[model samples]
Target: MPGIYLGAILFSLVGMMLIDLKYSLALRVAPVRTTLTVLISTSFFLAWDLVGIATGVFVKGDSPLFVGVTLAPHLPLEEVFFLLFLSYLAVVMVAVFERRAAARRRHGGGRSATHRAPLEESA
Candidate 1:
């Protein structure tokens, strides 16, 4: 019960990673860039949340859904995973789109660009 919320999030994160692997996404496609992207994005959001909490604009709500763990006064453990999930989502979306575009290019959406006759022959 202590880790219920966090556990669910971790499990889902694993699933997301598996999806990425299956599609050669993020870590598979560009491990370094993908890692940096996720780390930076999560850090930015966490900092933003911290600022809000400091300004009294954000407050932790009582939720049975939460495992009720906190990393700070009002920061829940699940908040971290939620951020992680968001980062993964972005990475996955970008990877999926990129893969689709690549597939299209490799297949035959447009061969004109790659196939060009000699200049003199066309004239």
Candidate 2:
């Protein structure tokens, strides 16, 4: 239904925004780098999707549940947006995990520093 498609779009946008905020605030990523990474990843996914559609690996069916113009069998412009949203979400999840791991390493290293005595004894 149109309602479902609309809801999907809204949810995707919100999710992407949250992910962006998390990366920006927690990872301290620059806006330019974030934007570039997302842009590049999205482009790659889109190209892959397009190829899949062309090769019949992915086919669209007649469904009123989708938004945008359908150029081929079940293929709609809106699918690109959906893919990009999902891809960005995946990247954000990876970034969050990496950030957590790095934090843990730093914290553990700091604690270990106190346990190890100084190499050079006081004269």
Candidate 3:
């Protein structure tokens, strides 16, 4: 009830983090890349949200989960957290696909540099 919105967001964030841990899709693949991806994506969208708020396109909605704090008019404190979750979600999505693709490639085997089977030296 009162905790529904914020609880859902926190749960999803934790779930994604756990998936990242189990697969090592983020830190193992590229820690810097994942960090930058999340940071840059979050910044871009936050800026977009700020613009929307300034332009009156965005408005804070009544929510039991929001702390009722805001950096600006119609911008709730929860929005920042939500944006971070969104960014993490995007990066995790890329990491998942990358993992699957690499697995597929490995299982499918690799071709030689010229796209042919590797030549074996004379036995």
Candidate 4:
């Protein structure tokens, strides 16, 4: 089970890299920037997770299915992977939403500058 979980984490990381590459090529965005954003966001998420675990909001059980040390009811390593997964998911979801919104705007919902009548017409 630990092996399976580790494999899944590896697969997710690779998948995220591919997705980032596609977005970078299509949008001319920087992969480094996206990676940095993910890193920062993941850091914050890890902090939150740590706090939550400390507060007993949730409990993490022992799993031979993961790597890294487990501190009581929390596994720091698992939390890190969870953050990565969540950040990747969030970025992809946002990109999809933005694309759909842009497409909708392009399909006649967007207002043109000329479409707005002058507030004060010339005499």
Question: Which candidate ranks first by lDDT, i.e. highest?
Answer: 1
Alpha carbon RMSD to native, model 1: 6.8
Clashes of each: 0, 1, 0, 1
Worst 10 residues of 3 by lDDT: 114-123
Residue 113's lDDT in candidate 1: 60
Tens digit per residue, CA lDDT, model 4, 1-123: 555676787688778768756765322365566677778999898778778887988677667777755644565466677678888778766777877788878887766656665763332
The regions of model 1 sitting more than 4 angstroms off are 107-123
lDDT of 3 by residue, 13-77 (tens): 89988888888878567888888988898889889998998898998888766766778888776
Using TM-score as the yardstick, the better of models 1 and 3 is 1
The lDDT values for all models are 0.86, 0.69, 0.80, 0.70
TM-score of each: 0.78, 0.70, 0.77, 0.69
lDDT of 3: 0.80
Clash pairs for candidate 4: 2-65
Q: In model 1, which residue pairs have backbone atoms overlapping below 3 Å?
A: none
- Give the TM-score ranking, best first: 1, 3, 2, 4
47-101 in candidate 1: lDDT tens per residue?
9999999999989987777887788878998998999899978989988888789
Query: Which has the greatest TM-score?
Result: 1
Which window of 10 residues has the lowest lDDT sum in candidate 1? 111-120
The better-scoring model by lDDT among 2 and 3 is 3
Off by over 4 Å in 4: 23-28, 71-73, 110-123
